[model samples]
Target: MGSVIEREHSATGSMALGQWAVIGMCMLFNMINGLDTLATAFVLSSLSAEWALNGFQQGILLSASLIGMASGSTFAAPMADRHGRRPLLLASLLLSGTTMLLSFWAQGPWSLALLRALTGIGVGATLVGANVLTYEHASLRRRGLAISLQSVAFALGVSLGGLLAHALNETVGWRYVFLAGGSFTLAAGLTGALWLRESFEFLAVKSLPAQQADHRPALSNVATNSPVPSLASQRLFGRGYRQHFSTRQWRETISLATAFFLVMFCFYFVVSWTPTLLVQTGASETHGIKGGMLLNTGGMLGALLLGLGANRYGSRQLLLGFLLLNAVLMTLMVPATQVLSLAIGMGFTLGLLLNGAIAGLYILAPQIYGTGERASGVGLVLGLGRLGSILSPVVAGVLLDAHWSSQALFTFYASSLLLAALAIAWGRGGTEERAGRSRN
Candidate 1:
């Protein structure tokens, strides 16, 4: 009687088609986000030439979307916890798609920056929806792998973007790249509106306000005796939120935020800057793009490995390992650049560890919050992390202008990961939170 039907132990790896579809679609959205993000990095060579831009100007262009992402994470994503995820996710896709399409007409740095910033907002909010939806929908056994695969989608997108950028940049020019990203995104959004399934848990929670008694059985259509009545009243930062905001949760949030920030600071710097930095190192533009692709390819494998290994070793323990490896990789980047093969190899390995760390963080964050606050908690952590993402590129631009070598930059960013490892070690949720997950 105390059990929720869906929570019953399943044969390992068993997943419903609906659950797979939701997670699969979320992966597609993440792919779109990745392509849209790296679109600017690929186009920078053309953009600088066209606009006569300086390092700072290019940094603005790169960072504009991230600023919007930060805002979306802080403000727009939290709304998913209150409203439904499907609509917000669909709306974000449409918004980003339209803005990206409109980017074809950008006249100057600020014009393109403005459009990109708007795109960032959509992408940022979509990030929250994708993670939360996947977390809520996936079964306990396959949950880690599903979430990790969702994270891999972004890396897949970046790998494809690198290839596409090289192909399209030379043929149709940079504007077409934005057009492609926009067209694909809008397609996903329109289709998602028609097909995306609302989370049963979200539905069950929503139904609680209208039916105070025995809500789960009616709303879920799955046998369940457990009823969490208090979820319906939990508004983020409102009075109901007070019910879950314990001192322990506060500490967990801070530590998660810190870990997210540091890891992401390094993540963006590597992905966004690797190609450009490689180009600066006398490699041709083609090799530069290859450098970027290699990173994401390694990332895909690394995340998959982490997911597969998660059930054996704990998620937090594997995550800390990834974080530590990342610091080591960053420190090695300078030496790797001395040889062409070594440079490419290092990019791939670093990407593996860095992207793996990110996937690990995404998998970890949602486990700390309940159905009611999951989106908000993850969004807050991701939003704070985007600050690091937003800051990294601009800082690189400034440091580059100041004549900082790639070695210095790589070494400097590596320390952020070392610190991030410490944060990960410290970010485990308190015993009360563990008890809650046990209850679930």
Candidate 2:
């Protein structure tokens, strides 16, 4: 029995070369996903000028990819559970890149919107797949840090894309930006195909218990000791899948999904509208671009800080504090906008806290489910959360069209943050109670 346990430990030992390779590839994938996701924002002013788009039309264009993202996260990303993370990730990269390239030839708003939506499908799937891969590859001790680093990579991509757009929009035109992003995505896809491996935990779960019987003694020992539930016994789908989860599991998923939805509502509104909002408030188009970059810059910093502190301070406590602070900062944004420097500074700080809240979610998400359900669990949360993204731009645009002040719009967004904080607080309480019961 002791020998069997030793073999099991060896077989399931710490992350190795393949795991590191997956982490590096996931980082690159997330960076490209970020670039593609935010590229529209960087080019929105230029695209509007060229296409002669109205506020409503522009809102549709901004929301188009987000709609696609929601669809992909809901429907396409879940396929990773059945087919394999690598295939879905590679396919998403290819599809998104091809569609984004096609966007450069768009003749009007309708064509561009269609292309953007298609690109978003790829971006959304890649986001989910890459995250699952990252989660599975890291050692249990470092998983939170790995996920947070991925967010940092994504944040850098957003900032870099904005800086690139600001530099090239006047000289090369917006079409070139699409061309560049598409080319990079295609290249990254090739790299991923060549280097990325499927998750080992995924493989272990898919293996039949009979086939893994030799390791059962060790596995049983692990089940008794580890916090992570054993996935070897769970079915991959259907009634068996439903039977796998208890009421507490379902409640945890629902709570996380709700918090994710509320936070994303606020996040997408800022990412999709901050530049345009700045322009509307009398800033130059260049200042608008700079504002977007500053926002993402703060996000990178926020993610870094969270990664460093999350293990020591506790993720839930940090998340709750970040959300409340973000609420305050966003409310203060109203007055800050009256001064250009102050507004830019506040945008950075708001982005930091906003992304800190998001990073907190990313840290907590993987802890809630085992390998068998991790992809689907994270995908569902993200897909549902994207409803906020899909709705915010269009709704905010209509309100702006009706002559709502920028201050009023921000105040409304701040309110969403408060609601999100409440959701997280509730989730924390439930999780703690569940942990206590499990311990007793």
> What local lDDT does model 1 show for residue 324?
86
lDDT of 2 by residue, 1-440 (tens): 13534434433365456667778889898888877887787888988887788987987888888889988887788778777889989999999999889988989999989999999999988988988788666765456677888899888877677678667787899988888889989999999889888776666566647555344332312432434434443345433335224664766666777888888888978876777777877889989878977888889999888877875676778888999988888877767777889888988898898898898888777666665666777777788888987777667778889999877888898889899888776664323223444666
- TM-score (C-alpha, index-matched) for candidate 2: 0.85
- For model 1, the local distance difference test gives 0.79
The candidate scoring highest on TM-score is 1
Residue 395 lDDT in candidate 1 = 86
What tens-digit string does per-residue lDDT give for candidate 1 at 7-125? Answer: 33321237778779989999999998989877898899999998899988987898888889988887788778778788879989999999999998888999999999999999999
Q: Top lDDT: which candidate number?
A: 1
**TM-score to native of every candidate shown:** 0.87, 0.85
Model 1, residue 275: C-alpha shift (Å): 4.4
Kindly report which residue stretches of model 1 are placed more than 4 angstroms away from their true locations once superposed.
1-13, 209-229, 237-245, 272-286, 397-406, 429-440
